[model samples]
Target: MRTQVCIIGGGPSGLLLSQLLDRAGIDTVVLERRSRDYVLSRIRAGVLESGTVGMLEKAGIATRAHAEGLPHTGTYLAVQNTGFRIDFDALIGKQVLVYGQTEVTRDLYDAREKADGIVVHELDGVELHDLDTDAPHVTYVKDGTTHRIDCDYVAGCDGFHGPSRQAIPKDVLTEYERVYPFGWLGVMADLPPVSHELIYANHPRGFALASMRSPTRSRYYIQAPVDDPLDKWTDDAFWDEFRRRLPHDSAEALITGPTIEKSIAPLRSYVADPMKWGRLFLVGDAAHIVPPTGAKGLNLAVSDVHYLFEALTSHYRDGDDHGIETYSQTALKRVWNAIRFSWWFTTTMHRFPGQEPFDQAIQDSELRNLQTSVNAQTVFSENYVGMPY
Candidate 1:
């Protein structure tokens, strides 16, 4: 088989890129190791930066999101149970759309189907060859048959555990990572959110976040030991801890309900430099991962897609390779920025083991500055809503 671009993932990043490229007259095929059902079953955060919303718009799949997604102009930040709002719109003239990642993937898949785009599923032993050369190809097994796909370029959107990142020579790919001591214990319930806007709270007890998927579907999380087992946390236990960390008012307004889903996600900031290796480019989780505190995981991937799509378009249309030549460095610039922000936010909001009183005081001082200083709030608002493309 032959394609202009071989995208080695059927997830949102891969599908979005294929959709954008196909619309631009670039031929591509997507290969996924898992079935579509399995891919859509994974749950993820969905705080959409304004730029991601625009990308969805350009892909013609934002209609449902715009109609049903919640739009928040600002979010609330609390310290020691005293909370204040950071108005993103008032400060930066922007807002975030809260749409679930599952829904976004579904929409992208639907768009691809409508366009008759090719997406292969359930592949085994996927491999990339000759990525350092101008031409690269991919090989995989579907059923009992082995198949080969020759393409001008390869897009490694297959994520952290996938083969795309592993294909890069160890000597060439440099990785940086910081694993936090804590994780987010989250629950999904069929109840209304405690607050209209998202609330990020810091307390002596721990850190808690009040968020929602929709007006009726609440998503909540509280910081916990990274090694803590889910069986140790019953529904009531999670609610009690969550309420304890929230501001008194939001805690009072919080309603308890049966949890539909629950899990603990470890927090970490990871980035692999030089997102591009010859004819292969890494996208989304394949190249970088940000701690969820700043909600930059998927958004970073979208930015990479934007850069790669633009670069690929330039190459095909006007024979320009500037974007391609600079893709890795350009994407890493934004990647490192988000990494720093996530690290800062996570450290400020969570209680570290063996942290001295001086450390706690510093965290308090920073939150107080954000609460009291308009200039500080503006910076927070800008980073929270997104730094810009």
Candidate 2:
């Protein structure tokens, strides 16, 4: 078979790109190795930037999001048992929504089902055997049989391990990566958010974050040693460590929950330069990944797709390929900015083991400066709400 765009991976980036293109009278096919059920139900980002919300609204996918998503003004940065709010609206005249990634997948799932130009082959794995050739094809097994798909352009939104980037001769692709010594032990709870705004706390023990998924569900995370086993993180252990790190006085009541989900996420930052080659393009986690400190992983993905859609649209309408040609460098500028921010935020907030008193004091002073200095607060607010598109 054939298409105008052959998209690998049916995650948010691939699927959303197809939806946007389809509305523009473009034809595309999405191939995924996971079942529709898995993709739709998977937990993803819970925060949406103002820009992301606008994009969803423009696409007519905001009905449920508007109704179910919780809106918040800003977040809090706490240290030494004291808290200060960084009102996003007060800082940047905007607010963000706390909506789970699962909700977005559901919304996109519904939108794609109603869209005619988009196709997703779930549970059928696609292989990338060649990419430098004029004809790049994805071969996959469907209905217990192998089939090959050909397209004018290919998008590798498959993620870090997908074949999209692997097809780029290793010698040609430059890689930058950083691995943290710790990971986040996060949990989904059956309790209302501890606070109206999220709280990011830095203590001598470690870093802890208090966030929410909805009015009734709370999502929280704490820094744990990278080598810590998943089994070591029990409900009680989470509560104890979280209590020790929180800057608020109502830790006991805030942590009350039945504990719905638990997992460990190692902190890291990665980027691949020149996000496009020939007719192939990359987006979302497939292009870059940021630690959750800045909450840019999902938002960055959305922004990349935003530019990709614009460039692709211009190419189709005016027959001008300039925008598509500059897709990689265009998106990389913003990608690296977020990476730097995530790295800075991660290193500044989380305390490493065997750190000297001077290093810990520096992080503490930085946190204090963000709370006490107006200029510092403004910077945090600008980044928290988001940078200009």
In lDDT terms, which candidate is top?
A: 1
Summed over model 2, clashes come to: 0
As a whole number from 0 to 100, the lDDT of residue 18 in candidate 2 is 82
Error (Å) of candidate 1 at residue 171 is: 1.0
The TM-scores of all predictions, comma-separated, are: 0.99, 0.96
- Model 1 lDDT per residue over 149-175, tens place: 999999999998899999888999899
Candidate 2 TM-score, true structure as reference: 0.96
Per-residue C-alpha lDDT of model 2 across residues 1-389, encoded as one tens digit per residue: 88888888888778778888888888888888788888876766688888888878766788998999888888887876677788778777888888887787778778989875455555465777556677878788878888888887888899988878877777778889998888998888988888877888888888999998887888899999867887898898898889888875747557474688888888889998779877778888887888899689988988888888899899889998888989998899889888988898898888887888899889888888887888887887777777877
lDDT of each: 0.92, 0.82
> Which is the leading candidate under TM-score?
1
TM-score of 1: 0.99
RMSD of 1: 0.8
What RMSD, rounded to one decimal, does every model reach?
Answer: 0.8, 1.6
